[model samples]
Target: TAAAPPRIFPQAQHFVSKEFCQTEFGIVYPPVISVSSGELIEVETRDCFDGKIHPPPNENDNNEYNPAQALQQMKRAEFNPITGPIHVNGAAPGDILAVTLLDIRPKGVGVT
Candidate 1:
């Protein structure tokens, strides 16, 4: 008989949903959560353009893509909205952090 498959379990200790994304990084903003090293955390992120430029809803529309128009659409204080404010335990200013991507499943049909 074949061995049973390994059961998959979610490892994330904390979850930061897409609603947590912000346009600016500031020390004044309280962290959504604090985490220690070797811990698993999951964060939902918004696109660089904050979903304003992507998903040309109607492909059949005659309107052509305009970079200028896209820029205008972004009325954000920061050019890129980031999904963070994660407080790393023991981490301080000037300390460099390294990230290892275990898995990444990107959604939608956009290309770099």
Candidate 2:
């Protein structure tokens, strides 16, 4: 008997490259784009989170400190916000984002 083959997902077609990883902010890099020569792509990125830290008032003023404030402060930060829905000058509906693969660099030993 023959062994079964691996499954290929339908949504995978959206990517030009089958081999790539998501950036820290979550943009998926396709293998084709990764290996392409002289190709530049603009990835919209934003601050990982809003800069906010709450420190209790100093006791030197005889003020009371509330540890419960940390939870309330957490909601103020935003996570992985995208900066744009930027429009390409010549891009129109039904136009495919064209890319060509020119290289594929392998990870070092013991690395993926």
Q: Report the lDDT tens digits of candidate 1 across residue range 10-32.
A: 66677776667778879977898
Model 2: how far residue 50 lies from native, Å: 3.3
Candidate-wise lDDT, in order: 0.72, 0.37
Best by lDDT: 1
Error of 2 at 61 (Å): 16
Question: Residue-wise lDDT of candidate 2 within 1-112, one digit each (tens)?
Answer: 5543232333232223221223233224222233232334433222333222234567776766554554355553343444333334555579876655333343232200
**TM-scores for all candidates?**
0.71, 0.26
lDDT of 1: 0.72
Task: List RMSD in Å for every model shown.
Answer: 7.8, 16.6
